[model samples]
Target: MNRSLVRHWIALLLLPLLAACGTTPSSQHYLLTAPEAPLPQGMTPSIGVGPITVPEYLNRDSLVKRIDSNSLAISSTERWAEPLEDGILRVVALNLAGLLQTENVRLYPWHPKRAPDYGVKLRLVEMDSNAERVVLVAEWFVYRVADDSTVARRLSKQSRPLPATTQNGNEVAAAYSELLYALSQEVAASIAEAQGNPAAVSAPST
Candidate 1:
């Protein structure tokens, strides 16, 4: 091929490569955090948190924003450091351990010997963030593992205003963390109340 023709083809090939490189920005990955500090030591029951579920739309790695009641947008450059459900489960477990001040907390599917006294089952109905606020809706149950008897069941609908300083994915993640922390408080209280711990009966819920 002629030199000019070969150079023209090379330029055409490089054009797409350069354009692709310019359009694909580096993604920012964020993680959901648990409460900063554990609560005071107390006689909390052995608790299990999990078999938790989230919405199908939230199963992806990207962060989501609600455009309106019917519309949604998924970010290309903002993403979760891990799966959303995994993050939720991990943070809930940690928060419970902290709130209850006991080392007997376990995730779902523990060995028969290590089975917790109370099993916490949660299903997240909605988890979304927008310019104004973050919303989390969850249905949860606390049951006695030994007798397979239900202790507490509740559906929690919670919202927190997005930080006025910023409404990025990081801030949204922080809001999610706070919601999960509140949920842990309710779960811990249920377990404690069942175990006859007076202090936990008054623990707050979201």
Candidate 2:
């Protein structure tokens, strides 16, 4: 090949390497956090939480933001530090541990012989966030482990305003954590009320 053609071929090979060397944004991972305030004094019952399920759209690693009613934007550079459902379970368990004042909180699928007194099953109907706000809708059920009888069932819907200009995933995660905390409080109250603890009925209102 001529010198010019050879040089052109060499340029083509180096183009990708040059582009790869350019500053590329790295992925940022975020995690949901639970509250750390001192728990109330009470002898909470053994509880199990889980089989937590998320929507198919939210089962991915990227952070999903709703652009409109029919549109969504999945970030390529912002991601969740762990599976969304797993993180929800972890945070909810922690929040329940605090709200219910119990150390016997366990995730789903525990040993059959060591079943908790009560079991919580959750299905996340919606968890969408945009610049304007973060919204969560969930359906949860409480049932007795020994008899498999229903104790309580409720649907929780909550939202928090997110600053219009905020694009950070950390804030979004924090808002989600808050929603989960509220849900946990409600679940704690359900368990308490089932045990005939009427004082805890309105204590978890937030």
Q: Which candidate is the best by lDDT?
A: 2
Residue-by-residue lDDT tens digits, candidate 1, 37-115: 6454654578888899998999999999999999999999999999988899899887877777777788987889877
Candidate 2 has a TM-score of 0.89
Q: Give TM per candidate.
A: 0.89, 0.89
Highest-TM-score candidate: 1
lDDT for model 1 comes to: 0.85
RMSD of candidate 2 to the true fold? Answer: 3.0
Write model 2 residue lDDT over 42-157, tens digit each, in one string: 54588898899999999999999999999999999999999999999999887877777777887899999999999999999999998789999999999999999999999999
Query: What RMSD, rounded to one decimal, does every model reach?
Result: 3.0, 3.0
